[model samples]
Target: MGRMGDATRTVPCDAVAVSSIIETTGLVMEFPSTRALDGLDLRVSPGVTGLVGANGAGKTTLISLALGLLKPTSGGISVLGLDPSADGPQLRAMIGYGPERNVFPDDMVAYDYVRHFAQIRGLPRDEARSRASDSLYLVGLGEERFRALGTMSTGQRQRVKLAQAIAADPRLIVLDEPTDGLDPVQRDEMLAIIVDVNRKFGIDVMLSSHVLEEVERICDNVIALDAGRLVAQGSLDELAGALGGVDVEIVEVADRRDSIDLVAQRLVAGGWTVARRDPGLTVTGENDEEVFDAVVRAVADSGARIGRLGRRRRTLDDVFTNERGDSSDRPSTARTGGTE
Candidate 1:
């Protein structure tokens, strides 16, 4: 009876506090041939969190579990203080999920489809209609809201999905590849809309995207998954600190071509590793202060003056690509478009 209640209850015994919107403990998911997730533990705070991973890295699997669309083979998941598997319907009511695929019904009008979703989420017919119209306009589809879905371009259809997702006024919006298949301008517009959704409405967002640049630009924190395991999770600064201790950039040498070797030798002599760049050299150290001191010492010893010297920050690409694992599925998500 106790076990039955555990399986049936909508709320987790250890409820999520204000600090975290989502938490998973020792999460595991196994298929017949492959383990989609392995002992994954994750915590998500408010604001925009980016879910990043190479294809087939179990990013989609994690998303599915969070939505309670797939029961985990082992582990527990809590969203908004509710057990996803046990209280899936209740949990999903507060979560707006936009899938990567284009599964919209072609014949229906955009506004009607969004309104239909709002109603399905338990809104009254009148309120759903009102919210749907407002959401479509908010997503920049107001002028075309009455148009048939089939008549819209890929970018427009993507906005329709966003409109429907927000129609119910959910607390958390989970967007998978929201910018996929969009042109540069469309992508920028979509990213802006995503930012506005969180800031303007006070909704938490989990963006699952392959574009590292966009994620870096919009996300407050990032979770990196690889081969069914969580390899990294933190604010961008924390992840960068863990991966790259400190990178000192030396620029504007008297003669870059000839000074590169001299600078590298000087830094190496100072017990620091140095990598050459076209316009500068990147020196590694234990921390910023230590790196700066070393850079000063190295420059003094080498008698080389630099126009600019500063600590360089690492990018998402640097963090993702430098991770050590069997990333055979790097392109798997690209091929599947994370549809599953």
Candidate 2:
């Protein structure tokens, strides 16, 4: 559930023996007037990684380039240390992909779809079918493995895609929005399966999603993208620690919303800036002792009973939005790009 990447080690060349699951440098992508990826750099270790970003934040582009589905206009790219452009077949064969986009044959059964990819990855017909069944079982879709793709629920179909990706026993698996369209229970189940695959089966994973909570809950490492560029890359703690400010939540008694203004006055008089406090709750600028004392005194004086007070940690969204806002504030002409 924490970040898993470390940049201290160098990438090896032979994929068959490659220790680094994925690596890219100065990776770039173009789309008419827009650049989808700019001088991006990325590295992934042998565990679950969260590729966190928005839909158009070059997340798809990064995956495509990394998977050898799209060629980079410039810079180096490799998955399992194999050049995706020149060694696509081998690279793909070593890696499994569950695309974010829906591009399935609606008429086919889940089993058939998975079996086809497994066979393509060079398994014999019987072996492919067997592995296909096994993969579907792993994703919790065993009962619907032979169900027509169009008839299954979105969650079921999502698992079908996952099964196909993992059917070949590849060393690495990439899941794009694996939890999309799933209920919380379904999401938890799917995540458990993914964790089992990574921890129990020893397969590395690269997961892409815009959901910060989901990523924060499951990923071992994170590579965050924003506005078609790398904004930050590291563990959750590292990024959260980079914050100069802190988050604090203050709670009060019932029907005491108007007490907020008085509370604010007390906090200000005590030298603390209250970020927000409408009624029963307040967010302070920081979580230091000075801020805490001021908030406590303010709540006590407001005559509103205190329910709870706690320090709030910085979330992934906060870090990314701040950096992206700064980037957007800069003059366009002054911008320089890079990739990950």
Clash pairs detected, candidate 1: 55-333
Cα-based lDDT for every prediction? 0.79, 0.75
Q: How many backbone clashes does candidate 1 have?
A: 1
Q: For all the candidates, what are their Cα RMSDs to the real structure?
A: 6.2, 8.8
Per-residue lDDT of candidate 2, residues 1-340 (tens digit)? 2234433332221237676777879988998888999998877766788887766888888888888778898989888878988878667767888986666888999999999999877677899999999999889888888889988887787788889888988888999888777777777777888888889887888898877777777777888887678877876566654333324344545677667677777776666655664334444555565566666677778876555665656667667757866533221211122111
The parts of candidate 1 lying over 4 Å away from their true place are: 1-17, 241-259, 262-274, 283-310, 325-340
lDDT score, candidate 1: 0.79
Off by over 4 Å in 2: 1-19, 241-248, 251-258, 261-302, 305-308, 326-340
Q: How far is candidate 2 from the true structure (C-alpha RMSD, Å)?
A: 8.8
Error of 1 at 163 (Å): 1.0
**Per-residue lDDT for 188 in model 1?**
82
